[model samples]
Every structure is written in structure tokens, then in C-alpha cells.
Target: MSFTLGLIINPFAGLGGSVALKGSDGADTVARALELGAQPRAQLRALTALEALKGLTFRLITWGGDMGELVAREAGFEPEVIGRQQGAVSTAGDTETAAMAMVEAGADLILFAGGDGTARNVCATLGTSCPVLGIPAGVKIHSGVYAITPGAAGEIAAMLIRGELVALDSGEVRDIDEEAFRAGQVRARYYGELLVPSEPRYVQHVKNGAREDEALVLDDIAADFEESMESGVRYIMGSGSTVAAIMDHLGIPNTLLGVDVIEDGELIASDCTARDLLTLTQGCAARIVITPIGGQGHLIGRGNQQLSPELLNRLGRSAFHVVATKTKLKLLAGRPLLIDSGDSAVDQALSGLVAVHTGYRDQVLYRIG
Candidate 1:
């Protein structure tokens, strides 16, 4: 028997991609992504994956406009958009309301495109009754509910609908204080539990093993981060212990569990503002030092919305520094590192082995999205 799925797209989710504006939630930044050829990023991944379901018969419920309705239609899901046409823009509050509607409407699985924050919003309302899946959009996805990649979300959901006896799992929904996280601080506290559906065919959840036991196998990659840092090469530490390894070696108190920016052993912007992040980058040239979210393999626009579009552009496509431990990379085995890119097209471009400096003026090609 087939199942029905609810899809919601946080229209403004992860719009910054590799741009420098901190995030894509603001009006100006949304316009900028469109101007810079990113209007389709949010829609394409879900659409293409849905459309690829050649013979599957499943129902979809979604929101109109920049949300999933428009993308679903293009993907041929023909979803029932939530609410009336309210001039084509939706707020975070509206997103929450729409999710409520989908849950009440009896969606078996609620799939959405966004980062950890969006997942939290849905979990707060729906809990575990309707399992939520993420399309890998937003800046930081600390939660365990999101698919490893956008296509993986659709592919897994389809498997479930096709009679795959999936197990139910509990996913983590972490909330980082954006204000505090940007201030070189991590006031991150757990919001609560999230519904994690386990269709072994869909996504797997393990956070690069946060202890010394799993870490022994990853010392080489951690070593790589340290050698690079000592060379005085700027480090844009992403939100994970892999990146934190460098900070540990430096003896600097890093955020440990949040995003922080450091230059020449000094914290320039800690838990900073989008404006402040821009200010921090203006005087000095910076390289975005980031590590993928273990199982997710994401490089940009996750858990760090402060790097809005304008600022992302300042960092540009080439200036990004993606660092991942060999153990984390092994999770994918042979798949190219995936990227939602916040914009589908760029996310597509994000595939393949790109150049990255590992350490000791030695560079290595790491596959990324």
C-alpha cells in the first residue's frame, strides 16, 4: 500500500549557499540569490527526486509559492497548498502553521527542506505523530532527522511508501542560540525530541561518534586540521568536533558545539551578527573553514545562517575551506560529497573532488557537494 507524504519548503531556507550574506531569510538576500542564479535551488532537489518516482503512487500535501506546492507541481506531486494566497511570501510563523495543517490533514510523513531550526519548528508542533524529514536546506542542521542529501530524502520516503518496513527512531533537535553562537559563544541547549523515522533505505544517523573510542580512527584528519591551523592559515571552524580538533591544538577555547570565526589565534567574530560578520570579513580576507555534519556531508549554509548571501559572495565559490575527517568521509564510502547549496543548481555544481588544503602546504582533493 502506498502512503501520503506532506512536503513543506521554507522558501527562504538556506538561500545564501556560498554567498556571504550570512543567510537567505532577509528580503534583500532572497532577491540576490535570484539575481545570482539561485532561484531554483530550494525547489529543484525535491522536485527532481519526486518526479523521478516514475511509477509510484503517493499523495503529497504542501504549501504554495516558494514552499513545496510550487515545486511539487513542477515535480508533478500536485500537492494541496496550505492557506490562501497571502501575496506569495511566508514568515517562519506561517511555516509552523502550515506544518500544523499538514499534520492534521493526516500526512504519514512530513518532509521539508531546511536546516535544524526548521526541523525544530515542525517537531515542536507535530512531535512524533508525523515523522519529519529534511531536504538538507538551512545553515546548521544539528538535528538527526535530515536526510544525508536532498535526493536521499525523496528516495527514502518513496521506499517507505513502497512497503518498506521502516523502523521508527528518535532524532535529535538541537537549538543553538544564534545570538550567542555568533558571539564566539555556544549557548546551545537542547530544545526537545524529534520524530525520526528509520527506513534503513532512507537515512542513517550517527554524529561522527563524539567520544574517544570512535575518534582513534580519525586522528589523521584531525591532525590535518591542526597542521593547517599552525601554518597561520585562517580557519573558519564549522560546527563539529572535527573542526574543533584544530582549536583544541591551538589551546583556544572554541565554541565546541557552535560556529565561531578565528584569525591568527584571535577570535574576530564570536557569536556575531550578519552585519558584524560582514564587518569582520571586510578588513581581512577570510577563508570559510567548515566540516561536514558527519553523516550529512554538507559544507555550507548549515547551522551558520550568519554567513548571509552578500557575505557568501564575498567568500565566493573558490574561497571556501571544507575539512572533513577521513572517518566521516568513509561514511559515504564512494559517493560524491553532497550539497543542497540552498540553491539546487549550485548544489549540483558542488559535486566532485574539489581542491582543499589539508596541511603542510600540502593539498588534497576532497569530494564535496
Candidate 2:
């Protein structure tokens, strides 16, 4: 029998990201994100993975409309439409229903696109009964079920369709309290596990939840950044606790999981969107301060999706300033920093050796890939 691949797309996933809403979990947040002009990219992300399967022979099944059918057709696949979405916008209940339908349809593997919330929904519907793979499309991707990038997820799914000997392992589904996350407090909870293809190179590891106890190290790094601030330059502060230290040093409120703009030692904007940054830094000297995810080592395309490619290209590679503690770099174990900006050319342009601020008056050369 031919392999049957089930597909699901959380259409609203990651919609709140570029708008700096932290996550697209609740209806209110999704509506607010739309009001803020946040564009939906989950369909595009799913299409990226589906396009990689061109000429591959497999039976595809998915939910109707933006959930999966539309993107599947765009990828030239005649997907068997299973269920119709409940309303104008699909809800978490729709996602759960789709998973159940896929399982009942005898799907060999399920491929889903979303963040940790989508992973949780699928896990709740069909635990370890079917092997699944995640295409990263959400803002809060603290879960271990997602691939490092959308294309990587496609490559792994292609492997399974070819009947290759792929190992299936349990990946944890984790979600954070968006309320706490927005308030600069991270509280992640373990929900459940799902059976997933074990491809360490492609699949992302769960984010490190342990708090950084090295307060003195953060102070030193923050001090180094504080010393480097120039007169007319706008600094784009990316998300993460490491970067938050600099904001703390400046006595400014940090968004914790959102982008902020600093200019002349003043908080110009907090929780900025991609469009907001573009407007603020247009025709102005600007620099970006970023830190890689602790366990994933992703410098972009993880949480800081607000750092869109256009802004990065406008600022150029020289405008990027990386900051991380030596311990964080050691955790990568020599893996080059990763970039999945959703633009291949941009990711290529940003790849090279760069100086990383390790501490006060300290730096080291590192590779960004």
C-alpha cells in the first residue's frame, strides 16, 4: 500500500508574531493581531514544505480551506479533503478534529504546521498512535516536535514517504502561559508527547527552561553593550533573556519575548512589529542586537520573527551585534549559529564569521549559518 500522509495547517499560527503579540493562541489575541495588520504566514510555511514533495508519490489527506486543502492544491497535490472548518476562522477544536479524522483515515504519518499550541492540540487528539512532524510556523515554539525550519520538515517527511528506515521517537509538547510570557515571566508547562520522526539535525530540541543564574555574567555583557552605544544609532533589541539584560541596564521595560527599539539610550519603541521597525529606522543608522536560542541555537526565525528580512537587508550584515554568555555558546558544542529567516538569500547573506560579545571587554569570533 502507498504511504498515506496526513496534513494540518493552523492558519492563524504565528499571526501574532510579527505584530509582537507573543503568540496567536486566543481569539482575542488573533483579532488584535489582525487589527495591528499582522499578515498570516502559516499557509505559506506549509506550502514551503509541501512544495518539496513534488513528484513524490503518496496519498495526501487534509482538512478543507486554509487549513490544508488550499495549500495542498497550491503544491499540486490532490488532497482528500476530510472535514470542513467550523467557522470563518478555524479554532483549536478544528485542529483537534482534523487530527482525529486523520487517525481514523489510516494515515501513516501526520505532518502539521504550527507552534507549541498546535502540537498540543494534535497530541491531545491522537497521542502516540501516529508519527507526526511539525513545520515551524508559530511564535512560541518551545516544543520539541517542530523542525528547525519549514524546508527541513519537508525533507524529513520526504524521507518517510520513500519508505526509508526512519526512527520514531516521542517529542515533548510544551506551551507557555502567554499572560506570564507577556509580563516578562516565562512559565512553560509539559502537556504531553507525540510520536515524531527522530532527525536531530532537522528537528529542534526543546528550549532550555532553566533560569540563568549567572547574574554577574549578564551584567558584564549588558555593560559591554552599554559602552558600545553610539550617538545617532538605533539599536533593534531582539528577544530572549540575554538581550533583556541590556534593556534592564538602560532602565527600560523590555518586552521579554518581543522586539524593542532603542535610540540614544532612550526607549523609542517597545514590542515593535516588523512594519514598525521599518518605519522607525528608515533612512537612519540602526543596529540589531540578537542572541541565539539556548538549546536550538537559532539566532533568527525562531522567536524573533519580527526581525523580517527586509529590515535585516536594509541594515546589512555589519549592523548585526551578537551577544551571549560563554556558557550559552558552549551549549551549542561548536555548532554554528543558525538562521532561518524564511528568505534563503537573506539567510545566505547573513552567514559568516562575526564577533560575539561574551562579557565586559571580551569578545570571540563565531560563525553564523
Candidate 3:
């Protein structure tokens, strides 16, 4: 199992900051700032934070479109998208709605991007229900909830995901009156505090912040795949990142987006087609190593079209080795992994619970719908 990280990016959070508009709160100010050629940087700031989590495992949940989905995908994450924008332009309402949805989805933490206004919106919706970290992207970052820099926010999130000794404390969310600021007066109001992670370090006797380098779990999965190899038994390596990891561990060439043939830990053929698969596995003891598409959870179809119904029938379920990271599987949120082999009989036979290889000597029972 993996922890769920909720994400929300205020697409227009810092639009007015660069154009000397003070802040981007009202619609008129945003329009004026845009006319002055101010570019939006909130999404880019969020992307920077997400990139630090590369090779780590966590379930990502976010709102559809610019609120979070676009940046999440850009960071190589297949986040579970939820909620809808109620207006043409994303408003504070959207942020509040997204925060509420994150809580309902059982998010262990919510990582948001934007300024003090965005922080206020999230604070109003979530209170202290779950921990949150803020990326500094707005012009007036008076909020204590925000990290000093976007990179710091990402590093803190990576520490939390790695199970480091990080203390959770309440951080104040404060915002100033932009109008008063233009008149040479300062008026800051406290919205409330949110749970945030602070003081990241490692436990005793552990080195490097005690971070386990969870990325090595791929090596474990690959080891398990190698152990399953038999003498002269042909293995049809399928398309997907998980299988690619196995090939990497074996130190062999792999056509990442295509099928391959291997035997005795050596690559026999590269980029095999449907017809090629049937011909190669005929009259031979063969097995397949496959993985589901992240987020969609499609075990078959949706890219592996080469695995036709006839081919699946010939291979049978016993010949299949389903592999995936627990983080990827958990992102499906209990929804069954899908199998669309294009044959009703083949699909039915492939249905029901199946053991998914998650790591070395680790397996989880998941349904193939």
C-alpha cells in the first residue's frame, strides 16, 4: 500500500505579481495584469515540486485540467482526477471544492501551489483534516504555510513520502489587503493554520536522512522476474514501464513500446508483432510479463493491441505475469484493472482476482474486470 498525495494548482495564482499589479485577486486586476503581459507561473512552480518525487511511490489525486492534472501529468504522474470547475475561469470555489474532494478520497497529505489567497481557500475548506504543503508562487506570500521556495516544498514532500522523521506542525495562513498596500498601508489578517511537515531528518543509525531509496523496489521486481525464468522457456515481454524495468535489471535491450522475445535471460527478438508472437511461442513453453497502464488500470488493450483475443487465448492466464508498483495500483482507488482483449470469452476467462507482482517476494490480489 502507498500514501495518497492530493494536488491542487491555482492556474492563475501569481499572474499579477510580475506586471506590478500587486496581487491577482479580483477579475479586473487579473485582466489588467494579462493586458500588461504577465505570464502565469503557478503551474510551472507546481511542476518543479513534483519532479523531486521522481522514482518515489505515492498515489496522486487532483482536480481535472489546470487545477492539477496538467502539471501532474507533466511530472510523469497519473493522478486520479476529481471535481469540476464551476466557472469558465478557475475561482477560489474550485480550490475549495478540490480540497474537500481530496479529503473524501482519503488523501494523507495535500500539496498545493499558489499564494496567500490560494492558501486561504484551501484552509477554509480543509481546516486541519490533513496535512498540506504550499509552493511559493504568488507575489504576496505572507502565508507561513508556503515554503521559502518551490524546490523546498518538493523536498519536504519527498521526505514525507520516504517516511523520514518530519514533525507535523500548524502553519499560519495570512494575507494582506492589496488595496491598502497600494495606498502605503499594511493590513494583514490571519485566516487560520494548517498542518504542515517541518524539520526533516533521519532516524538513528540510518544514513542519508534514512531514506530507503524506494526506487530500488524496481530492482526487487526485476529480481523476481528473473527468478521466474526457466531453462528454454520463452518469455514474451510486454509493453509498459514495469516490464522495461525488468529488462533493465537483466541488462538486456528492450523495445519499450513494443513486445520482445527472450529466453535464458537473453533477448531473442525485438519489437515483435501479433503474428510474430503466435509464431514464436508455438509448440514452446512460453510466458508473458505485462503491466497495466497507470491511472486507467487497463491490463490489456489501450496500447497493447498486439495482444489480440486469439493471442491471449493461446497464452492463457497461467502464462501471464502481471507486474506493477503498489503505488500505481493504489491510484486506481479500488477500481478493478480492466482487460479488453476484444473477445468476450477471452475477457471472461481473464476476469476475477489475480496475483499482481509488486516487488521482490511481494504480491497483491487485484480484480481484473
Instruction: Score every model by TM-score.
Output: 0.65, 0.96, 0.54
Regarding lDDT, does 1 or 2 come out ahead?
A: 2
RMSD of 1: 6.6
Better model by TM-score, 2 or 3? 2
Q: Model 3: per-residue lDDT, tens digit, 121-182?
A: 99999888799988766756656676644666788888888988788788778788878754
Q: What is the lDDT of residue 270 in candidate 1?
A: 52
Looking at candidate 3, the ten consecutive residues that score lowest on lDDT are 202-211
- The stretch of ten residues in a row with the least summed lDDT in candidate 2 is 335-344
List candidate 3 stretches off by more than 4 Å.
200-369
lDDT of each: 0.64, 0.91, 0.77
The residue-level lDDT of candidate 3 at 164 comes to: 85
- Estimate the TM-score for candidate 1: 0.65
Candidate no. 2 TM-score: 0.96
* Predicted model with the maximum TM-score: 2
RMSD of each: 6.6, 1.4, 18.5
* Tens-digit lDDT track of model 2 for 225-283: 99999999999999999999889988988888889998988899988999999999999
> Candidate 3: how many backbone clashes?
0
